[model samples]
Target: MLTHTPEMPHALQQLLDREAAITTLALPRRSFLKLAGATAGTGLVLGAFPPPAGAQAAAAGLKPTQQPSAFVQIATNGDVTVTINRLEFGQGVQTGLPMILAEELDADWSLVRSRNGSSDPAYLDPLFGLHMTGGSNSIKNSYTQYRELGARARAMLLSAAAQRWNVDVATLRTRAGEVIAADGRKLGYGALAEAAMALPVPEQVRLKDPKDFRLIGRPTTRLDARAKSSGRQDFGIDTRLPGQLTAVVAHPPVFGARLRSLDDSAARAIKGVKAVLRIPGDLGGEGVAVVADGYWPARQGREALKLDWDASSVEKVDSEKLLTQYRELANQPGARAFDADMAPLATAPRQIEAEFIFPYLAHAPMEPLNCTVRLGKDRAELWVGTQCPGLDAAAAAGVLGLKPEQVTMQVQMAGGGFGRRFVGSSDYVVEACHIAKAARAAGLDAPIRTLWSREDDIKGGYYRPMHLHRARIGFDERGNVLAWDHVLVGQSITTGTVFGQFMVKNGIDGTATEGLRDPYPVPMRLTVHHPKVNVPVLWWRSVGSTHTAYVMETLLDEIARATKQDPVAYRLRLIGDKHPRHRAALQLAVDKSGYGKKQLTAGRAWGVAVHESFSTVVAYVVEASVKDGQPVLNRVTAGVHCNLAINPRSIEAQVQGAALMGLSMCLPGAAITLKDGVVEQSNFGDFAVPRITDMPQIAVHIVPSAEPPTGMGEPGLPPLAPAFANAIARLTGKPLRELPFKLA
Candidate 1:
């Protein structure tokens, strides 16, 4: 293993390490390259992470990753292990990406395995140039990258076998884990891996034509499926290290509220309680972390603490008052996202004015937030299922007063994280580091595991920003949109983060207005209002589209209703030929659902909605009914146009899960309410999610396309709620405005 010296600059050290990695990949075979406290074992290891398209021109000296050896490693037993760059939090990238590579490498599917990557620069996203995962772009961005990696590795293996057999490299072909000579001699990959690694990595290689792909489009089961199904899969929350101590923090009642006084007499008296120390929390808030041998005692200690909070510095956000303020702001123009004439709205033959309220939502991954930090004299190590390890490491360095390179953020498999783990502030990671630092200062020198209970995870801040969208639309009898005026009011999720500069412009956040009046080509003038609030807000699952799509789709359906037009036909007419993907998806959903053909149950009505987000289009044709004083989604038929399907099963899984999450929004108690500056919902009892009894039967259909795949993680969610609401409206003859279907 190669290591960096103290006097060397990190960049220069990386350069030297890069050279060594090249040597290790091409000639020395068994050598490993170490960086940022990450250690590699004997096998082929990759160099830098994949770069974005034209990223080389974006920055000087940046190039696409050239070392194919870095990603694929063939063990002696013929098992292939692929290193995945992004976090594997239930999105099948761990399987899909490897499938892309292994498809080109022609490896046996059963022997393929996957491992996680850390904050090492080699793990940065190929497109975004960051160590992060969100936007549902993981497969879309990395498709070509992994394909190329596998192709190059295959070339190297062929060359190695050719040399061994004394023949031309062009005469060799690769099959499942073996290279075949023209004379029918076969050499296993494990036998040739060392020699293959010794060969110089080819700068370029030809990718396989889609027609020849064995794994790329196949519906393969995830490599982690069985372990996950049997509950044997390990998550970061299950991490255990010797001498590890658990901590439970008592947060202030309000956002940014500081602890005025703390009495830890009873807490410290607990048997396993090691110490109780004050620590900083999200939004400049202060809290007490109770350290104990395990979670139970730490939680008990936290419950025993007598505390008083000072909330004078923070705004006391009340949901009722805030909604009123948002409604008032909706009438006033704050910033222009789209400006078009709205004079025709008043004189149009039909008109509709709608206001939609989307409550703050929690990500609520199965595993609550957890981070384990072990501090050394000059360095720190962390184990967590973080979305962006590099950002988390930097934040940890600041909290530990160590150099960024001194901190190693080891990535782990997460249970789930729609968008919660990818925080701009690295809130949970920083909080864990702060607890570690304070414990060290208090002379409790042990590895600290900070755990958030289900209650803590739900009440903890960084929720989806509550949004109110008001739209006034006018259309003719033919369903041609004459004029539309729209306003969106919400807190900006990126206003104060590193992304603010890129995502916010001229006082308007791009995220807030993303899903408004697009693909429909309506002459819509959109105004956005970003009110400052003390409550913390972050992206949750589908981000702005969560509310924006609901508003846009439902309103369009209403216009279709008023104009006596079929919903699917109207949406297709608006989309036209320009947006083939949208039209195709909507048409597919309609065709597959047997809309205007298939008969439904006596009370069930057809609901239709289509939306495009993250460069992918999803259309939902749902059969729904109002049962037991609630809107019941009986079945969902989804038409997904993601261009190319990497793993159709994964796409189906994502759609099913995301659609259910969308359905959760329409159920009672789905909203996360704020009352007098405190979160009203603490657990699943008050903060509702979908139960097994509530799950609707769903069938996902992919539009056949040879184009590159788009995002699949988020697009399926946006259309579900609106489609359900549209059906509920048909049943009651009154359009539903708010979520959770407040039936009278």
Candidate 2:
């Protein structure tokens, strides 16, 4: 229970002073120039007029939004509670964050509990400059903050015990909720709780030396494992409230098509149908809501409702037509996303060319789209599972014509968001607000839960835009790459939408052009972004990397085959020094799996792909074969570097799950097909997902690093598709240049 202050031990101070002196005179002459430009710009000047002594910029993170609280609160009864801001959403962040806090707090592990925090500014992300949980930032971003919180709390408790015992704080030590003095006298944390609160907050704290860390780097069971297994926990689908009525909407079969008219006479006659409202401009399109005493009655009433749709314009739009148009647009000039002026070397003696097409994909979350809104004249409250609650609140208020504060958003456990939850325009939550406000204008209780049928959720707007890619690589007679050219044509994810404006300021959606900038540093490289401008699109799981990684990694694999070099060895030479973690993972995966040594059955082969996303580096090797003339993945091995490695088990779970999700998206996951602008796949029967029998044996190896934890949820997704696609090419002796690989 030693309450060490900011003052360092004299021995440590002397050691640091000697090290600083040694570093100052050992640099090269030009080092000072670089330091002046970079280090001096950090607000310190050596020879110039120094600012007054006390003018040091108030310790970097002193913003009004930053909070000093981030650890466990031990109640008098020994119940340890924690307030976490990161959304759980089945990512296990709720469990991972608390593990860090508990280890530093020195709490009784068995008595600890965790919960989500209220929407407060104290939870802002230091990186996003705002409060957000997406981009795989939950654990990577909060680990240190949460740990510091515990360390600060531990210091406070030690100070309190020192005051009560009247003993020198250094003679006291803490372990598992008790403060013990050298004389063997002990005091529980609960006994000193009040005194601890009165102590001044420390300006600095030291973390536990890694060798002494007990819980971290160790496999601890998930905090919510019991509740989920026993079916006691409530997900969004199981939510309920008093006096709540069920409602359902039978929206149009296509986007931009309005409801010209509808007949609800049969629906109104249903047994439990309370009201059938033909609302105008609901969700800025055709809207019809059937309200009933229960969900079953509303569902039954929806089946009887008939409507005349204004699908004239959309009637001409189709998936096949869009695909053809995208290919045509790829040849024409659009916005240039990244350019390297490779036109001088365009006429090389030897060149390789290929085209890759990606189809439209859906974010069919398990819970579908649902929201419960209770609206009054100037006040509203919405209960839903959204990734961005602050943004959701603003959108809710705008739709209801109320001030932002008038709307209260309760973030529930999302079944899944991916990138689907951040959507602003044409959002389901916006539609729910419209429905609730409309119901109130009709003078009812004004509280209704809008439930989107599985079909509506699938056929609705905002899909992963279909993309077409054309690439040409110029090589010398020595087989060295001389130039690289890539042309991409696809619907800009941010065009003509609220988010599109911010993302396309320079007429380029950085997301759409990522992974194309060519960090490979070839002699000449050019990437052109041609905006297709078709249907409304949104970000899916890995955003642009989902498609871009496939193109880049698969093309590199082709080059490896052309050079007759090992794929791993070839990528190792091309990686340069951009990402050391990626290199480490590549080497580890290649070594552990014996990647190029063994062969599976004839006509079966393996492929390797590596990528860095959300701060984490991941590499995947897949073993697959053509089954019945279709690519079938039989096994997968992955190496991940989520630095600092919080809960190795949880990281493994995320990597395994993300790999499976990626596999399903590549092989059998659902896609949106349009015929005359009408989506054909309405539900799971048509939009297939991976079943248990479809999963391969996935093995995960975690490479530990001290680089601070990065994102683990999504980095594993980008490489799976390319790995599987490359494996298919090896097995069939032909590169499958499109998604949903079709073997011949």
Candidate 3:
């Protein structure tokens, strides 16, 4: 027995009092295109087709009030607005998606504008049937979808013009947002847009050949570059509402710790302090929130409060003890990821056993987490920079006791995410909803903005899990691996979350063993141990490949050195002819880097490594030197094969940015450690990130191809650290088995 309404479901309405006065804001629509009737007796709205079966099933329990459009809008002024289904977040999806649609639309690049889409059904990832922007799948998944959308829109526009002129549609062709007749008459898309909306959408539209592309594959500048550079961009942190109040919370030192007692007398005395309330935290804890007119007052009021916490029930994890436990676990057999014969290990002429350690890392985006919630009696609205708006919207509905359709998520621009904003737990959003509910209970009827400071953000839990890898490899003089036994000890990132159903199989997490064996035809026995730790962990950048690539590439380089062979030649022999992309990428980097022809400048040495991740291959050739007992990366050249380059400039920027982050992993004090269940580092003072002075000169070259595009975001990151470390190993003659490269 379920009560259903156009607005919401009955199960959610039970939590709300029907008699309560609804407080709805008269805010202007900020979600997407608005369909307003024009004077010309033409339908302004483009009707959408019925949802696909997958999308319908995903939205069965809770139907969305509005369906997502197919991402094309031709306004009366001839301005073509393209809506991106993913967050911009400094990645060029804002520009790249538009380039894709505009290419097929034959729209002039100068007249194209892009907007960030909200948590709508139309914006879900076509393959996953989920609203998300991760795994570098933005362009990879939406490339064809957007192109088809543009082609459809173009077809309708031409059809509209043909009907108006009483000519066959074949006689009308589009060029730069204009429908032209074979006899030289032309009509701008704007004049045909309203009329085009009445025609039925074509079942299929012909796409342009790769050779006819004017925008795709071009090295175009980002559309948001001017706004971001001139400080005109409004990130999530910059969100403001008419009656919004700033909020700051005092969380317990240990995660999931409850508040025992609180004294808020001093906090109430602070000027502009509105309300102080205790609210439930994300990880089954209770925290105090201070609400005020400004951030400083809220922060000041929070600092003035005195509270006692009870952390006895939670595990007090120590980084040192955790590593010790992992080391012990690595020594024993664990869940099998890959099984290979171990009998060949004893007969091998040479063997190498090495153990590698990687510490936890924080995503630490420039803009800390901030979510603004305005709750009414029947509906609510949220403004935030989210990677998964639909997921966050559902989580908000659950927290606010409202139906999913009653919530509106206005996606904002983000400084950076690096896999931080897309949490399965939806911890940050839930926390904000809790604070807002508490504020309403305490008689503060206004939007609440829960903000995180730099310290709070760094200390906040979801981190890249710490891992320990132990490998036993047996190889011959010719650099052929006989047998390799490897074990990885770490917590499974997807163990208890929704992703665990498909991502964790056969008692092993695929993320932990993604780059173990491939492209080299290695007979390896790989095992993994996933310990249940108290620390919250999530994906960081390239996920497991962040460390697995380092291990595989560096070890292969070691084998090449042991055999007295050129690293590139050894890699080619191991890769064989099956992986031409790898071979071409490696050879391109080598030739461009002048590896064999150029003489080293005194103490510098050349390093080479190549690896594939996310269906894209990236190879690096680096020059490094040791100065004052520290490794210094001087210059690097990258060869990339991501199929087709949507925007070469975007690819170049992504590679340079990812490479710098990879280099940051090699610097001292870059690791995040915990002692007694408390994060050791607070801000950049302790946690090291690369600065301008630390960046190396990097040149990116892409392999030309007409094939469909693959991911470029993460593939550039995997090979960078290993290539730099191999060069350092050459100078020191010692294998570096740990991150932040310790030399004694």
Candidate 4:
């Protein structure tokens, strides 16, 4: 509704309405296959398997009619196929997104399959005006649009079948992939697909009511579960083409640092090594590409190569000094996001001050970053799991001096993205393009494929910037915070990058300070965003909430302690009518947790926190204890309000995973600094992620609402840290300020 087209012709409107009636054949199709040796197809089919008969439309009302991408195709067979426009990195989005549409289209669930979409403007992100997936916006952003597309498709298909059968459209109804007449005559959707396509699309389409929903809002296994589990699913790294050569780049040790010299003579001596080209940067830092017959050979050649780095000055940075400097800078002047006009200090009788820290974290996606590029004179084709396909296309073309249209970005399954894949810098892809370009210059006969090893991925850090946070809260005897001031100092996540301006306002990056101040009934609120200029940073899994939730939620617990009130009651007092979902999630967590109840042990305690992001509201209650010097979190209960659900089971899975991730961030996962500004933590061995054994027993409750569901991926991340921090404070009888909430 925020950005909708005002009007369209009735003819066009009708075409939009008849979308669901098309039935697709389950033919193997690559929507965006590179045209190196193979011809490109005319995009994917638009076959939809609508929700079961009588399933209600998603409660979150959708636009009356709209044109979605041509990615959906219905063939002459009864198959319903969807071309997924977003990248899938083990988040189950490949299945989750289509289910939302199928639920409204009343598509037969059994006849559904999905394909990854291509880099085309037709399936662009409405917010950023491009086709890509990141920012946990997949569900929330596509919810209404995709549902309406399904409804429209259904209306069109039914109308076409009615026309063929010489029956009134009103008298004909669609069931599964068939059109059934009141007289008992029936035609399968596949038989009427072409006719439906020829008919005019409907502008106004009817949606199902929630009560009639048969397949949506239910916990069904992933549609791609079998393919993925059986190892038949092809990820970006699995791509292989005829005459493709593997390449590895030795990038600069530092981002801005350049290569001083390179000696790849030994690397060139490797039997399979095709070429050792000075790619203009360091292999690990940026300039040279080592090309060989395959991945193993390319890696071996890279290992044999040597280069001199001009990292003398940049190497001055040590992790300990960086952290100390961040703390010092936290107290300095910075950009202010929110400011409160507070009276003199005499206005408040009580004051409290606290400091916090969030260390640099890595994405460490299982698949790492890899891309296959075939650069030709007229066109360039890339197969990878990139979040910004348009940008990826542009960047790839930029290196090859080609137009954006000249680049074909073939989308593939990402092992995981978490924002790392979304950024414009295709470190691996860019290197591959350079290598291919250099190869073409040398008249090589093949394209280049680039791969990043786990070690290289870890050492080549694009981390969630470490942060130093400090807060001072003043309250009256009643414990209502009269004045609040907070400062967050951290490396600019977007300083010299593409999203820098949008990210930094007057010097503050919102990603650096989300949920920084509580949106409560407080009298005064002030927060500062101090940009730590020198260090490098990037968006991590949860973005800013990774740190903001830790600070705000923990402080709220502090406020509750000082006020002698139950944490749940305290939060309820401040949470008003801003968003019904927030209230519902908070209250549900409190109720389900049975706040104030006696627990199993005298030293153990429970803590509560709530955060809303990407339109979803979540509340978490954590019960934990300290044992053997490490924090042992025993149980966690969360309440989520996603409004209308596509799949409850998937939502639960996301929430459960996010909860564990949050817990891991709280203690186990810390990218410590060693000598020479090097990260001490390299792999899972050094950098700890929560194992299945460390997982807390979690019970998730979903609050059903009639609204369109938002994203469930990262909303569950914000509350777990603070809940544990507060619980630790109770056991130790000390205000726990630092992260990893280590016991003394």
lDDT of each: 0.83, 0.71, 0.84, 0.71
Candidate 2 pairs with clashing backbones: 1-173, 1-174, 317-677, 494-500
Off by over 4 Å in 2: 1-72, 280-283, 313-316, 343-349, 376-378, 477-479, 496-502, 517-519, 530-534
Q: Candidate 4: lDDT over CA atoms?
A: 0.71
The top-ranked prediction according to lDDT is 3
Q: Model 4 — TM-score against the truth?
A: 0.88
In model 3, which regions exceed 4 Å deviation?
1-70
Worst 10 residues of 2 by lDDT: 1-10
Model 2 lDDT per residue over 1-744, tens place: 000001112222322222221121111111111112124124221221222344322224333222333334555544566667766777888788888877887877776778764334445454443445677888877787877767767777888889998878888888887788999998877667557755655657888887777777776778887888897776655667776777888877666678778889999999988888766543346678888878999999999998888877554468787778777777776666556667645677778899988878888877788888887667888887776666667667777887766776666777776767767463778878777777676665846888877787778767888888888888765446777777887777766654454457467776687666354556534445545443567888777888888888888888888777788888887886886777888877776666877757787788899887777778888888877767788888888877777788787778877887788666654577778767788888888777787788887888866567788878888889899989888777688788866565
Please, what is the TM-score per model? Answer: 0.93, 0.87, 0.92, 0.88
**How big is the positional error of residue 215 in model 4, measured in Å on the Cα after superposition?**
2.2
Of the pair 1 and 2, which is ahead by lDDT?
1
Model 4 per-residue lDDT tens digits across residues 552-614: 888878878877888887787778676667788887777777667645576578878898766
- The Cα error of candidate 1 at residue 721, in Å, is 0.3
RMSD of each: 6.9, 12.4, 7.5, 7.7
**How many clashing residue pairs appear in each of the predictions shown?**
2, 4, 0, 63
lDDT, residue 107, model 1: 92
Model 4 has a clash total of: 63
Error of 1 at 308 (Å): 0.6
